[model samples]
Target: MCILVLNRASMTNEQYQSARLSRDSRFDGVFFVAVKTTGIFCRPICPANPPKEQNVEYFTNAHMALEAGYRPCLRCRPESAPNSWAWLGAETSFRRALTLIEQGALNQSSCEELSDRLGISSRYLRQLFKTHLGVSPKKYAQYHQLMFAKQLLHHSMLSISDIGFACGFNSTRRFNDAFKKTLNLTPSQLRRHGLDKEARNVVYLAYRGAYDWQSLLSFYQKRAINGIEKVTDTSYERYVEISGSLAWFKIFADHEGKQTVKIEFEMEDVTKLSTLLTTIRRVFDLDTDITAVESHLNGINHELIVHSGLRLPGVWSTWEAGVRAVLGQQVSVKAAIGQLNLLSESLDYRVSGQLVFPTPGVVSNADLSFLRMPQSRKDTLARLASHLREHCDDSPNNWLALKGIGPWTVNYALMRGQSEPDLFLSSDLIVKKIPKN
Candidate 1:
């Protein structure tokens, strides 16, 4: 029953009817405007004929309209929201469940463990899924598996077995069965490259909408982690490490038609595709409705976005995000970057023109030689990194509680790394102080 109190912009009858009459970019993702007469819900930007004035009703989201029994609009395809990221939106328990599944949680654990982590019961979790996503959590996980397998078949020359293992399959039979169950085509049938094809060695991760190409590039280029991440004409290339293994990624915007961002990946560990893609999405904040976001910020009194929306900064990797947060405890970005460069040169692993992030094992095992600073600060950051290494599971709560890492650090890392939108750094000293009324 959670709902977001979105901004209510004063609109003219023309604008309102235009939005209701034909869903257009102005109202996109702002609200789920339902026509009482037609019994259908659509994005503000639907191109269909406008409904009668008296027949229109606006709900905060499609979820809300759906709860009230309105069916999705067929013409606009409201379900295919480009802004699934919903900038600065609330994070519901269902979203948390989806994130966990993307992290390989369902594959390794169960519904019980998921509920425990979210601080809810298994029954409650199931109820939430039924109410929100309309499918059981397991079914969603199955859909996710099929997606991974499909991507491999289309993008890489990996055998069905390699794709299966990379996507968390126990056996080729299970992978094949699951692929067939969700998509009628067998894994081999739908492959873009058949067996014995030369490896393209490239995979593209689809991000939902258009981006500020120059802005996104400039931000990373300035603070681009030395060897680990590099900016190219088409992408921002980087080294990614998951579960102690290494991978390579090239992230860029697809300028073909409307506009979309893409991640071109090259890796040997195919089983980690699901987790990798999920993490990448979270890190980059894809699935956002760019049309809706620009409107909301533009509507904010005094234009707070003008000051801060200079760039949509995304976390390159969780480990790197955490490390930066730790170093930046009370220091400026310049100061933090300086220290991390030293730390990077001293401890990080270098291969294939990408500097690998210093792993938890290294932080826990070695003394803080490069992290030289106040003894207390040194001990604090090391302890946090060590905790990650020892537990081998970097949960949100545990990640936040580390010393020198307050809500600011945790919020920055999570927003960048987990795509958690509700995390607004209201207390950031540099941010204009709006009284917390």
Candidate 2:
């Protein structure tokens, strides 16, 4: 029943052995080691003695290991390992499907509905997951929810009921049943042996390698919307709307040994926790494979090598990013901030001293003539809003088809809105300044 899901050639047995022997944190989530003798899977950094190579099997993800009948190791707590940023195969559809799943697409929707959103058949989608991940979509989703709940149990002070709802279970009874069935332990039992202190409204998100926090914070400082976002030297704070609830969250790097960013939030609705975490992970590019990205850029240029950890900061919402991109065209960053602040002030949705940006419907129907911008730009904003309101699609090509959005604007929107990593702004004035040897 063991599924050798990951491509074996990606890492040789010797490398995995070395990593496990040395208890290297770098390979913690890249691949899990399942011991045949003990029927348990562990993170690479597990403190237990290294199992004999012949007794070992590797999996690309925790779900695969679980499918092979290996229970998670309690010593290492594989649930807390940083996620593997590497995609298993070269299939773009698989990657997109994985992203959507991480965003809770499967929480309340069928595989068919997810397939429809991905523009593929359910059969093909299931096949793709099996081929690359060695599990069905439903199983994968279930594992993710359980793992998240486990992490919450270990890391947070939240009640078991709150954790269950946050992880997408229907009720406390169901959550308890799931915990008992899956882990052979009740939720309270797990909480009694939790690792961290009972910190309220806090979560630690992990990322591999050194994060260029200054670069990301500076980028956000320039484009920060008034009353919505604020960036300081060591922290970034923002008011976010999730499922109609307004909450403020702050993120700062954990200066301790763990390579993680700590996020703290104030909110009443616990169900939105999963969505909020996903959005924060995307916005910070936490899942980027820094090693691969650095290797790809190595020898390309000296500058690229110097700042290899520079991440493409993403926004909370596509509509917000699109609107900001439109306002930023042909204007200085400072001017764009001023304009956005003005727009926020004029909007009607105010909550907790923060003004929520207008929705596309409101912008499309409103008379934006008072904003002191040129008539052409105003008309373009209206048209963009209307187009966005009419269609839920947020692709770059779709934005490009609009009247005023050109390559730069489209690419900017894609980079920030969609968290696209490979995009480059060739036409950027700063990029143009780089000398071509």
Instruction: Name the TM-score of candidate 1.
Output: 0.71
Model 2 misplaced regions, further than 4 Å? 1-9, 301-303, 351-354
Deviation in angstroms for 91 in model 2? 2.6
Tens digit per residue, CA lDDT, model 1, 172-260 = 99999977655555877766333326435545543333456667676677777777778765567777776656788776666354434
Instruction: Point to the candidate with the largest lDDT.
Output: 2
lDDT of 2 by residue, 1-437 (tens): 12222333467777777777787766768889999998889998888888889999888788888778787887888887777765734588888888778768898899999999989999999999888878999888878888888888877778889999888888999889977777767889888877477577777888776678889998999888877788999899888777677777899855464778888887767777877888888898887767656765664754667775787789887888888888887777788778888887786656555677777888898878777788888888898889988886657667777888899888887889888777898987667888986
Model 1 global lDDT (CA atoms, 0 to 1): 0.65
TM of each candidate vs. truth: 0.71, 0.92
Task: List the candidate 1 regions with Cα displacement exceeding 4 Å.
Answer: 1-91, 116-119, 155-157, 192-199, 208-210, 302-311, 317-319, 330-332, 349-355, 391-403, 424-429, 432-437
lDDT of each: 0.65, 0.80
Clashes of each: 12, 0
